[model samples]
Target chain A: DTAVSQTPKYLVTQMGNDKSIKCEQNLGHDTMYWYKQDSKKFLKIMFSYNNKELIINETVPNRFSPKSPDKAHLNLHINSLELGDSAVYFCASSHSTANTGELFFGEGSRLTVL
Target chain B: AQSVTQPDIHITVSEGASLELRCNYSYGATPYLFWYVQSPGQGLQLLLKYFSGDTLVQGIKGFEAEFKRSQSSFNLRKPSVHWSDAAEYFCAVGPFGSGSARQLTFGSGTQLTVLP
Candidate 1:
């Protein structure tokens, strides 16, 4: 079974359009995270939720919001997407809320804004 | 705050040759270090990690890393290189015991190119 999965493996949208990427993990983990990989292959943590509670929120812009309905699901929504928002978004999960554990990542969703 | 640095942006190795990727980190205390590999069009996969035990850690795909506290570095090495091993490697560091910081800081990443 796929440990972690994300919907819409590829997304191409116009500027100013709003889109959401849904993620689900069956690893039965308590912590889920959203990460952005820019064109330079720089991976940065966007947000993290532990048991549906907001745990980590980086300095991401307000237009980017993360919603965790449950421990197994965490979704990312971006409003009025800008060109800078074009990047690969990854969903990952770990056994605990601690960052010391290894994370299981999904295939990732590639977002392109034009 | 913790940060990771991968000095080599790209490295090319011939098939069957040994490989070593360097990674340095900056943290106040003992940190949790990890090496992750990302193939083309795929997510990151944990290759190995260093917590507290033996400085040398064995991971999948015949990859291993040694934690050198003196240098604040955890470098990944492999005995032999395969074309399939060509991918992007990332080094990450996380606070060891700080409960407040629950995120890992990843390095820019090193792209491995295995030549036939």
Candidate 2:
């Protein structure tokens, strides 16, 4: 289907361990982003890539790294996962030139750090 | 500071009743506003967005939102809500222009509970 798809919809791992979530979009958009929804359901942007170039990075820790292999894929790798790192991660994409500013999102990957 | 605020954490409405969810933002300049809905255990779906032009914007799934520059608010409304409308709603703000590289800042979210 033509949509933003992410792998490992649900992940449960022990603290201090590492894990990664991969996202792919077929929307042919130049901009992709990673957002984290906390337990309070507050969504916050972690990283943003436009045309495979990192353009925006919030105050996220260095342990969380985002790699965009191509314009269609953006992967997030978390090292030494902490219990507080557990949250639902979302992948979104949009046309940078679409002034209306609509974003298409993935189903989300729920991470539970035990 | 740039942030979005959703005053009501939870709102309950009877089926077939009208619904309104409040959203407020604090930004230095006029920002691009958007509303997104998330069903239970689902990803966010764009309801509508207002970048420029008309203050009132129509969205999918019978949703609509009005941008009030004076109040710094973008509130979502529905004439009649369906039972399936029970979900979490989020309000977000982006940079002022389409060429800006800033990411979105989302509100905490409001959970809508539709009673039968």
Candidate 3:
């Protein structure tokens, strides 16, 4: 069974279009995160939520919004997507108190804006 | 701000040769370090992590990382490289805290290529 899963493995849309990517984790972790990997393979954190509470919100554009309806799901919604947004988006989860600092990632969602 | 640096952007080695990937970080206090491997079309997999205690940490797939506090480095090593081990490796650093949220900062990955 997949511990973490993300929907729409590939997404292609025109500029200014809006899209949403859903993520879920069955590991029962309290914290979930969203990361963006650019073409240069530099991964950066975008947002983090703990038990449906927003914790870290990087300097990302306001167009990118993260919503956690419940503990098991955290979805990313992108509005007014630009060509610069063409990259891989990854969803990850981890236990809150575990000092291991190990993150379980989901299959990335590749978004290409034309 | 915490940051990670991977010196080698791409590395290629013979199938039976030894391999080492260098990772360095800058943090104010003791940092939580991790090594993750990413195969094509798949998510990142946790290979190993170092919180404290022994500097040397063993991970799956015959991978090990040594944390050298003096050098501010955590380097991953493999005794013998296999063709199947060709993948992108990422080094991450996170703050040591008990909060329910711990966000990781990842380095620009190093791509490994094993030549048979």
lDDT of 2 by residue, A34-88 (tens): 9999999988889999999998899999999999999999999999999999999
lDDT of 1 at B88: 99
Scanning candidate 3 chain B in windows of ten residues, the lowest lDDT window is B95-104
Residue-level lDDT of model 1, residues B13-78, one tens digit each, is 999999999999998877889999999999999899888989999999999999999999999999
Question: A25 in model 1: Cα distance from truth in Å?
Answer: 0.3
Clash-forming residue pairs, model 2: none
> Ranking by TM-score, best first?
3, 1, 2
In order, the Cα lDDT scores of the candidates are: 0.92, 0.92, 0.92
Error of 3 at A28 (Å): 0.5
**Which residue runs of candidate 2 sit more than 4 Å off their true CA positions?**
none
Candidate 3, B1-116: lDDT as tens digits: 88899999999999999999999999878889999999988889999988889999999999999999999999999999999999999999887666412657888999999999
TM-scores, each model vs. reference: 0.95, 0.94, 0.96
Best candidate, TM-score-wise?
A: 3
A43-109, model 3: which lDDT tens digit per residue? 8889999999998999999999999999899999999999999999999998888766788899999
- Chain A in model 2: its TM-score? 0.98
- Cα lDDT for residue A42, model 3? 92
Candidate 2 chain B minimal-lDDT segment of 10 residues? B96-105
* Model 2 CA lDDT for position A26: 97
